[model samples]
Target: MKEELLFVRHLHVEFQHGGQKEEAVRDVSFDVGCGEIVGVVGESGSGKSTVMCAVLDVLPQDADVSYEQLWIRGGKSSAAMVFQDPSAYLNPTIKVGRQLIETILLHPEPVTEKATQQQKKNSRKRAWEHAEKLLEMTGIRNPEEIMKRYPFELSGGQQQRIVLAIALACRPSLLIADEPTTALDVTVQRQILDRLKRIAEETHTSVLLVSHDLGVVAALAKRILVMKDGEIIETGTAEEIFHEAKEQYTRELVEAARKHGSRSQDKRRISETILFQAEHLSFQYTKFHFLKKKSTEAVQDVSFFLRKGESYGLVGESGSGKTTLARMMTGIIEPSAGQILYLKERWKSLQKGRSKAQCQKIQMVFQNCAQALDPKRTIGEALTEPLEIRGGGMQDVWKTEAAETLFKVGLESEILEKYPGELSGGQRQRIGIARALMLKPELLVLDEPVSALDVTVQEQILQLLERLQREQELTYFFISHDLNVVRRICDRIGVLYNGRLVESGDAEQLYREPWHPYTKELMLSTLTADPKKMRRRRNVPELTSRGGTGSGEENGCPYADRCGYVMECCKKERPELYRFEDREVACFLYSEQHSGKRSKEYRMASQI
Candidate 1:
């Protein structure tokens, strides 16, 4: 039998809010065994994080927490935590190397005051060595260079790895990860999860993983705890929880995770006319330090077209320029090079300078609906503000239209009276959609619209978007890091890496057989709740991803360092988007210049 590392029983927590005591977590109980991983999963506000906080004694002073029995083998100090956002926890001013080394020196044991200078020096040296080793263990290469950079200098994946390294620095018996990959792209999320699994096996650390993503939980956890309304509804093995849950909530969660709406078999025919096009679009951000200017291309020469009533997905990881491309399409930011054609007409003006008619033709639903919708304004005002700005509509008419639009988005007319703060995440998202629809725009640029919502809520929003698209013949330029979500809604998908468009083709076909190395990695990185599929994936070898030292500076293929099929030519010259039947992939393996055995096999596969 496995040894139990941490145990809690009958845990209850409450906080004082608005003159009332609100129960955040109630009657929660669970245990983590040595070298075991346990997952707690539920929607937002279900108190998953609260239970972990209570265990760590990190709740606010106004809160009350208690348990019938609570114990860990090595006490709370022997535990370390990794949160969702690494940036929030890490110091911006300090180098990550120092931060990690500092954590190592402070934990387990600190140097005694009576120790000699040489002893202290030796201890510090050991800590630095351990820090680099931890960084390497988390899949970070060239740890010494990474140590010299601050948190802000690293990519999101790198930053998260640094945080994970810091947490492991103490050699803690227990590691609590709270929605650690919630904001990460699928590939990076896989890397982080892989690192966690490896560390747990190698160090015998117990992990308490908390997340709303059922797929993520299913991917890593041996045992799963289903939480809802501040209580654990069920506890079982991952296979049992995902496939044979007795609780309705657990079943519903599994169903939602599995149910990405398929493209309608009788989908309406998309118009042949191009609604928007970006020709060799490029954007550069110029930064100055000490009176010296340095320019970084956020987007490189790229081209893509969206047809009327079609959904085009731009898929990539964080910092892959998805948002930058979206901004260019929406006129939020003008491209530094190339032309934007809307309805075959050149669009040279920024959003502010665009005519009212142009504004009415394109609308955007921002990623953070909370920030997009003003806290001070009612939902009705938010919906009507666009019309008021565009003019030619009375206030009463605007309000009436707002109500109708709200109903279209599956929201009640009564929602208009509520403030953005009073509404839930799903409600805010619907409100954002309703506001975008007030203009009855021909195109909608959705930037990670459902990335932050629960899986169930994400399904609802995707369905709503599909319904709206079909009903209104609205064209969608959707951008996201989730390839699974994109496959569900997008007709055609483009894969981006380091500011370049590497592949573009039918969404289903791309998903079925991705030609680009990066695209294939993305598909493999996608975690699902299906037990059979996960078992097969577990047998696959870990592939190198496009993150880490020497990966960002490649002048040829951005993925050259990570590509399993990379040839010597890949490091010398960049490949353009070469045509292959109906698909286009930017890799030498599919190009005429390639003559190797692997290239021949890839070419034959492409034709098939």
Candidate 2:
């Protein structure tokens, strides 16, 4: 057997919190061989990230770190890390290119031979070139344009790619990616993972990928480490983890991942009465150049309806027009070419004129709670804004209601007096939820509401939402990339791809039998906690080039490029919605000619 690129033997990490010793990492041991991808899987507070931080010597000064043995490549070890939150890790004020170039220059290789000095200089130049290539490889459209931009100017996905590019600039033998793709959309995530895999293969670099996502780990990692509460509970290959897990926690994690793609519910009749409808919903943004002009169609010809007391979910990868559609639903951005009808009353008509009561009927909770609330304002003020805007004059009564709402979200009333900055991410999210509840809206649009939360907090929020829906008879339009949360809360789900609804059906039915390829891929990509089951699953195939049209162009099947069962008509003619038992799928595989002929092919592909 080849020598491992890196090894960790009996590592222990701790911290002194309030003068008491707290073990963050306990007797953890792992190895990353040359060109190997080792994944660390765990929920929040599992100390997975803490182990990586300890290895990098990036932990806080007060952190206590001990290790029996630590070794790396070439009999000398140096490593670099890419953090989970790019916004917190990257310098917001500096140009990304400059920062990357500076990082490369700062890490000069030890020159031995006289001729090696010139070789090292050449390596530095190659490193800079590789940095630009890395950005492009990671799916950033224009590398030069992105490099010129600062970290804050880029989107979350773009920032993550930039950080990844910088981490690779040093040409380190071992790289640590800490939940690097957690904030990315599914498509972007697929692209990013593919790039990392390719880089690792080409450079023979080892990777320690820490993530809560099981699907990501399955796709990229060969060996798996399952952590719970700062301890390694299980270790195995991907197939063993996914298929034959022995631990109860491992089984629960597998079940969660398996459940993500399934929607099992007791048969509940869905009424035909549509409470809210969006007709020809279209939105666009203008792009101004010196002399050229461009208009980006974010949401085009999108139409959907929400029934009273029904939970509807919108699912899609990043930039697939999920958030844009959510914004239109909440009246934050008016549709450029469509009408939003609330019980036969158009939003345009309401915009021209409407009562406060009518306006208060719709409310939204955004993805980022920290940015949603005013930093200077206390939580009390933030929660009461909607009430004040609607002229709900009973301030004292609403204040009491606000406290109750906070309490419902597992928060104390004392949190009301605290500023947004003073609250934790989870607390701020609850405050956002509290503010939305205060409006007493008939339809609540939750846009990726629980994506930023940890699993435990997410469970609490899910239960809270379910309870509120039952008690208040609230209709929800829940938007999320997390299929597990969607399965747990949504009654019906609408799968969107590049601004079009490719699939929609009862959540349970859809999960059990996902007809659309995109939907299936999304389900397959989600990770579970089980070590044995995860190991049993095969590696996800790399996304193939979809050589047909631009993203915004109208298509029969938006996923035709990535779909494994593509036909001739899939390229030229777009597939229309075809009924599949209880769901609707837009794919030629379900079309007339290939429907029966493709059944075998579909079964074979489904095994993936």
> Each candidate: what lDDT?
0.86, 0.77
Candidate 1 Cα lDDT to native: 0.86
> What digit string (tens of lDDT, one per residue) describes model 1 on residues 546-607?
43323444566877877778777787778888876668888888766584445434544553
lDDT digits (tens) for residues 358-382 of candidate 2 = 6688888889999999999989888
**Runs in model 2 lying further than 4 Å from the true structure:** 1-38, 60-77, 87-162, 190-204, 214-271, 349-355, 419-424, 530-608
Best by lDDT: 1
- TM-score per model over all chains: 0.94, 0.80
